[model samples]
Target: MSTTETHHALWVAYGASGVVGTIRKSDEGYTVTMAGADAAAGTYPTMEIAKGALHSHMTPGSDWPQFREH
Candidate 1:
């Protein structure tokens, strides 16, 4: 079984650009913010959806990186 734990934030990296975005957990939900952004792109109810949102928000034609949770 998977244990539930507190997750604050996670960094996203793709290709040669390391740490391109972030997924932050809040009371409302998970928020995805790209690097150099003033505000979050959006919030999702689940981390899976948040991950998908991050992937969708990325630049077109880019390969998906192997996401590692911290």
Candidate 2:
């Protein structure tokens, strides 16, 4: 038997600095796309969960890491 799949695309994050993200609905869970960093970061049971992860990564720290590791 041939199996079928459904795809649901959602624009979750968008704002200044050209930072954007998307959340796609899947049979298993949801997927998030934050900038060009991570395509398929991971699969979460819920959109909220996935969003939390995305936000964590998207949020920059107090300062950027130094170019030299030291």
Candidate 3:
């Protein structure tokens, strides 16, 4: 018999208005999706890059917080 473990990596970013965006670990890379968006903004090879992408996608003046594992 063999055992397999699965991991679902997820990170959330919050702002003054509430949930701002999220980064989900995918096979290709980290996928960043902004709030109320119809599709993902983009995908990055690393979490750091993904966070940066999410921040850049945020609207001006939005109070975004550090990404937290969720």
Alpha-carbon TM-score of each model against the true structure: 0.73, 0.60, 0.81
Once superposed on the true structure, which residue ranges of model 2 sit more than 4 Å away at CA? Answer: 1-7, 61-70
Pairs of residues clashing in candidate 2: none
RMSD to the native, candidate 1? 4.6
Point out where model 3 deviates above 4 Å.
1-6
User: How many clashes would you count in candidate 1?
Assistant: 0
Using TM-score, give the best candidate's number: 3
Model 2 Cα lDDT, one tens digit per residue, 1-70: 9988786656456544544556677787877666676467777888678777666666565222111110
- CA lDDT of every candidate: 0.77, 0.61, 0.86
Which 10 residues in a row give candidate 3 its minimum summed lDDT?
59-68
Cα deviation at 42, candidate 3, in Å, is 0.7
Model 3 residue 44 distance off true place after TM-score fit, in angstroms: 0.5
Question: Could you tell me the lDDT of residue 46 within candidate 1?
Answer: 94
Cα lDDT tens digits, model 3, 7-62, are: 66999998777889999997789999998999999989998899888988888766
- For candidate 3, what is the lDDT? 0.86
Q: For every model in order, what is the number of clashing pairs?
A: 0, 0, 0
